[model samples]
Target: MNVSPPPPVGRCLDMCPMRECKEREQQGRLFRFETLVGEGNWARGRCKMRSLPLADPSKTVKEYSRPAAGKKLSSPCDLRPPSVLLKTVNYLLMEVWDHVNERDLASLAEAYIFVFDRLRAVRQDLTVQRIQGRLGAFVLEGSLGFLLCAPYLVRDLPSDSYDEVLHAKQVRDCFADLMECYGMDPKCPREAEFQALLLLYDLGNMDTINRALKLPRGVGDSPQVQIALAVNRAYLEGNWVRLFRLVHQLDCLQACSFYRHLPNARDNALRVLTHAYSSRNCRFPLDLLVVLLAIDTTGMASEMCRRRGLAVISGEKQSVVFFKASFKDSGPECAGREYILIETKRGDFTWAEIMMGENEGEFMRPKTN
Candidate 1:
């Protein structure tokens, strides 16, 4: 019996740079792989080889590998079988998020990053393999959607260092892929919720508005979509009162989507209120400010006023004295703080409820007084 040579060792399998060269070669862009070590294992040991274009063999280009000195290797999760990847995703969503609240801020931040990376890797794998059907939908809709909404739900997580815009774009891209491959039903309430989220992300963009209009008939009429459109109108009209009222009507995930726009809304509302309530003799009640601005607390509302060049009157009736001349238009002061309405609404639903879109009727409607 002849023994075959041991399979070449120390080669990068997943995310190999030479994979691109092989693909190019298949497309008629011929390249020759040159081995730099013993046995000339050009086929498998890409880390020890370089590729040269056959048309210009004298001009060689080095194909960097994952195992190159000082380079970090790809995550082990990248090489996991599809079944294992699915189980890992399920574990993170079912086991981890259910008890995420118990972790301290430091641990929460670390956990968030770890979970995000794992989910991202899984998504990439599923996408690259063109996986479709039930498995793809589960990962895309449940795991991926949770990732999009998480930044808002989990507060103060040292996110300042990340590229938020790039992150949003990546999530949007994955969602688009999901819609294209799995086909979202207009009748599905979850679809409507996601459509509403996409619209809310950029309310002022006409392109976004047109996209919402183009959705199948009932989608635009869904409670979530209707609320999002109303919020858009309120935002454009600078009607802060109506805006916050509509915001209160949104479910937890929708509210999380709307969180990014809060600072601008608050700033604009304060400017208008300062002028409307401008008086040396009269003061605006902090309690009313809480309602009008949808702020979580009287203390936070008072602090916001103080930061904006208004005076907080401390007495039996806490009030803010806003002089139009004294009020400064310093841009949005509180960007990431939580609101009372959102917090209360958040408790009304669980992680699974939001992910799976269960209890549709209850989650869709705001709690009635």
Candidate 2:
């Protein structure tokens, strides 16, 4: 009978990290190498073997399976969750993914846990630039998650980084452009609709202020302008109580309804708030007004107050009260040329504007926009 040549020692063993590889190594026969140096003692110098291709060291089989290995991971937005758990988790994950994808570090950092939990293995293919580009498109598509998270993500990026600079400008400029597009006019068909939105921007009482600044091109007497005036009036009047209350309501509503199925929720809110804080209102009240002013305007309470030459002292439990003995002029043309200069109150004060008298059973008549 013809004898077959012995099979090469197992070269594939080199790539195996299993216990069998160790056992083979201990026996000094770890790999499948085709050539046999000596005859097998039991076989009587007639080795039974088959020739097999040697293992390519450069292309060895890998054992460990990483989640992000090989294929690209799909976006959280890609899969729509069916169950509540899946929905919540996916929504939460989408929040993070959208933030990171939108290049919004500030927002991602705010809800960091939500983002960090969804990440599995690191992919070599995904880069920061790619993420930012995807985010830019997402923003253009009016993704509220991106809009909500954009501020935070952009905040987290390095101040000196080019992306940071561009994104920061983009958020403000985009908001301004959108406001201009809508044209803040109380006569807007949606004026009544945007009332709550005006409050969100602290512009609820803006019509009163427009009456004060009677420019030929009147402050667009819209709900948005009213929100701006409300913020300014709150700041001017040094009414922290009302300011915080309004902001808390606005923030709560925005946070809750940001992506709710409710129709026009996000757009309405964004429209109102954007117009309110983007104006050249009195610097004093703007400083003390927190919430959107802090989120949308210049900065935090103390810095805004300081910049306006107002005294900001941290009161009990981190409450900030701004007080300054500076006089400012405010009055409508109906009040004649004798503009009233109200004296600044030093103490933490709260005063309500009295309900003005109405004409012919119109005490609470909702003024038509």
Model 2 lDDT tens row, 1-369: 999643222222222223433343344442222112211332232223523222323222112223455742233322211222222323333332432433454433434332222211111011111222322222221322233333333334444332434443443443333233234332323222123332332233466344334422233454434444454565456554454344333322132222121112212322333333333332224333444332333334345345434444443423333232321122111110100111121012111010111111332244355
lDDT of 1 by residue, 1-369 (tens): 999643222222332235443554444343231223222444453332344322222211212222458754343322434565555565555555655653477556645655665567666656545565545665666665566567675556555534466567767776676666435332333567677877777776678777787777667788888889888989888899999998888877777777778888888999989988899888888999999888888988888888888999999989999789889767897466575656676675566456545533543354466
- Output the worst ten-in-a-row residue range by lDDT, candidate 1: 55-64
TM-score of each: 0.69, 0.26
lDDT of 1 at 112: 61
Top-scoring candidate (lDDT): 1
**Best-performing candidate as measured by TM-score:** 1
Question: Model 2: what TM-score?
Answer: 0.26
Would you list the C-alpha lDDT of every candidate in the order shown? 0.64, 0.30
Candidate 2: lDDT of 65?
25
Q: Which residue runs of candidate 1 sit more than 4 Å off their true CA positions?
A: 1-88, 101-103, 131-136, 159-163, 181-189, 336-339, 348-353, 359-369
